[model samples]
Target chain A: MSPQSSVLYDAPGPRTRRRTTIAAVLIGVALLAGAYYLVYRPLEAKGQFTAVKWGPLVDLADPNLPLVWERIRLGIIATLTAAALAIVCSLLAGTLLAVVRMLLKEQAKRRYAGLPAAAAYALRGLNTALRGITRFCVEVFRGLPVLVTIFFAWRISGISDPLWPLVIGLSIYNSVVIAEIIRSGMEGLPRGQREAADSLGLTPFQAILLVQLPQAFRIMLPALISQLVVILKDTTLGYIITYEDILAVAQQMIQILQNPIQMYVIIGAVFIAINYALSQLAAYVQRRVSRVRAHKPAAAATELAASEPVVLDA
Target chain B: MDVLIDNADVFVSGFWLTLQLCVLSATGALLIGTIVAAMRISPVPSLRWAGATYVTLVRNLPLTIVFFLTSFGLPELGSNADFLRVPGLSSVFDRLGIDLPYFRFAVIALSVYTAAFVCEAIRSGVNAVPAGQAEAARSLGLTFRQNLLSIVLPQAWRAAIVPLGSVIIAMIKNSALAGAFGVTGELFSSGQNLTSSGGNPIIPVFIGISIGYLIMTVPLGIFIDRVENRRAVAR
Candidate 1:
């Protein structure tokens, strides 16, 4: 359509382009292989490779495996606690923020049209500053590695064991993401719905809570579910803080028992099960929500129709 | 302050090693992931199953566990340690004069773990591409690969970049876990050297390591977000 488009279409003959692309890919693969050989072959030659030892892994059944079970239990406890905290805190914080902003928007619309120009400018400035602060906070939290944040929290005065720091860090970081999802969901609501609610004499709080929040939640459920999954997986970062998450337990098992690889495989299976289960649950909830929402009007109308006979008989 | 300044040289070397491992492994995983993504979308049922299984396995598993599999488990299998038996392979490898066992293990682990998410991201990216684009390419007599490379991938890559970038950032962060492997080649000798020293300030040491990770992860995150924003604007 444009000169650039034509140039792109004409730049290389198709045959030449195909050959170059394939060649580039092949060369890249070969370079990776060569690099691997250069770095890994020598390490493999070391005694790092030993015959399969099942004894240490099997010894897990023995009651004397004190730290092993403690590590595993503590890790699971920490991960679950962190996940629950993040979800609850983020949902509450994000919803409150979204409601406050939406309320401010309605007030602005009502107050601004008749305002003097100077007052309008002041109002606009205040709005801009609020949005700016929200963005800055989100960027700062999201920009930092969750692990760094957790480490910072652990080092900062009050918190003791690594679990609290991890949970607090997760909550702060994930709240930003949750807030964004909420803001976007609020924006997605049709203007007509807002006008309809206003015309019905509904208060701003009533309209948002009764008319809007339900719909927004439905729209955002998928994102929220995926965020939960992310947070769940992110719990693995606890291993760094010595919080005894699944990975930490695996690390302890590997180090104390000296069967590093086998234990790792077992740990991997544990994480897979946890995450896969979460994903499946998310899919189930999504389907359930959609189906219920789809039938809402029909179900409501059917109930109304069924009640009409009783009203007439009475 | 004096100790930190004294250790600046080790810190810089560690930074370089971190970059090397992250970039190399990210690239390797991206390649494997792209292939798996293709397989996930392939017509063959077996390929699709393989892709699905791989994505499920890697996406769910803790990356450290995968790293362990590479660093320690492979040797137990016996096959992983065997010398190159390819025609003229051993001689060529020798001529290059490279020793790469640790590199290979790291690459394998990082790539396999990364590929799972890559598959998910790329699959979603492909899903985002309108069916019309593929139809247009096919109408032009482009074969499957050509259609994929020309029409689907570029568009899908745009959609895929955010999640893929997140996964890459995850890999970089997870690269710090390499310290736990007792591998000397890793970037942060944090877990080992700190624990071994026993008296060193653990907080500063960890904070320093965190800063190092921030240096690696933060910029990529900004870039990816920027790219995603641009794509949003374009669409």
Candidate 2:
């Protein structure tokens, strides 16, 4: 009904308006009937809608409610702990890998001045080899499914603690993804960012560390937050390795309560709530970043400083 | 190495199932996604809200939970609503010799989950079409559907191809979850079975499995990059 959406068609006349109302009513009724038949009736017939089935999770008067909450609280703490560890590890490793790969690429392209010809050739070979190795690792990690990576970590790495394997696996895969995100962010910057750094007499490494990376990170903050949500979601995979995360704990509760549907619904709701909040934050940050870039370009440095800690808190 | 060479058929069949899951799920996602996209942009406010609600709910829920709901929860609902039991459709699948209900459930889960991403990709594509293009089409006395099909969607599809490819590639990776949830013979479960039952070395079995996924994903990655680069050049 907005003017913007109306761009696709003309404003409705009286006859068109009547037709639209009739169509909308019919569609809405059909949708309601479909939902009733597909979801409500089936669930009702199965006794899933009974208060007894939902009492453990929702009813305060239930005797087992406190114990259930305790388990869920601990499960949430465990999931967050793993997610935090993975987020920290991946951010650091991803930044390092991105910088090192960038440096190695520059090294491969640069001529070694005032060096022996043989030494220069050998250095070039080393640069190329390092770059190749870096590329290989990134590709391999990015290509493999995170579950397989987690499985490998759990099985082959001799890590007895379930949390470490989950953390290590998530960190590896997510670090590679973050590195690519950072690399693309840097690439998206105007050429002047690099040229200005060079004109200021900074070495390639120093320029990248001091100048290019900060801007890239700032530009890619929304992506980084979204990836954090991914890490949080993936921590649930620890259930496979028996890691006592929220989902795993939910399964344990189901054994005693015999309410798999209620438990999973609660668990799913928790995840959806958390992830939806994170994604909304990402969208908010994206909007703010673009606004900051658009207006008052001169104050961007201070604005960037102000915004940094808010994202890091996640 | 010898382990992989001896179990070549296992790996082959595993990857084949993975490929089939991807193809079927991708098709379903595309069909459902297109309809959702249409609904999201339709003139009806209720339809728009419905589309938005669907995308938000599905996108936020983890795929594992979606799989759990479809595979375990559907059966518990006691509905005789087997989607494959439609009059003529069951016969087509019967002819193809693929009749695992769990496999069908996995496909349902995957298609439903991945369709959210596909819907977002298409909406982005629609946004990429200029306002003037739609206005021009409307001024020429074209209906909304005609304007969308002739003017908007063609350009949108072109703009959407790179993102759609990435979505498909992600779906391929996600199909790994199907193996764990009970759809056997996929790459992940095959690796799991080989290591656990066959007593093969975990490293080699996993390595073989990773190779199968890379075979599916890496080439697609390259193709996406090439298409993206070509688009950039065209622009």
Best DockQ among the predictions, by candidate number: 2
For residues B1-235, could you state the per-residue lDDT of candidate 1 as single tens digits? Answer: 4445666666666777767767766877889988887766754344555577877787777665677677666664444533423346435333111344654566567778877777777776776677777777777877767877889889888777787888787777666655555435355654236434645665566556656767877888789879967976896
> Candidate 2 at B88: error in angstroms?
8.6
Model 1 lDDT, residue A104, Cα = 62
What fnat does each of the candidate structures reach? 0.24, 0.52
Chain A of candidate 1 gets a TM-score of 0.68
- Candidate 2 Cα outliers beyond 4 Å, as residue runs: A1-4, A13-15, A296-314, B79-81, B85-100
What TM-score does each model's chain B reach against the true chain B?
A: 0.84, 0.93
Cα-lDDT of candidate 1? 0.65
lDDT per residue for candidate 2 within B123-234, as digits (tens), equals 8777777889999999899999899899989998987887788788878888888888877888899998998888898888988999999998889989989998998789
| Candidate 1 Cα misplacement greater than 4 A, ranges | A1-75, A97-127, A201-210, A248-257, A288-314, B1-17, B75-108, B132-143, B146-151, B179-235
- In order, candidate lDDTs are 0.65, 0.83
lDDT for residue A25 in candidate 1, whole number 0-100: 64
Output the lDDT of residue A217, model 2: 87
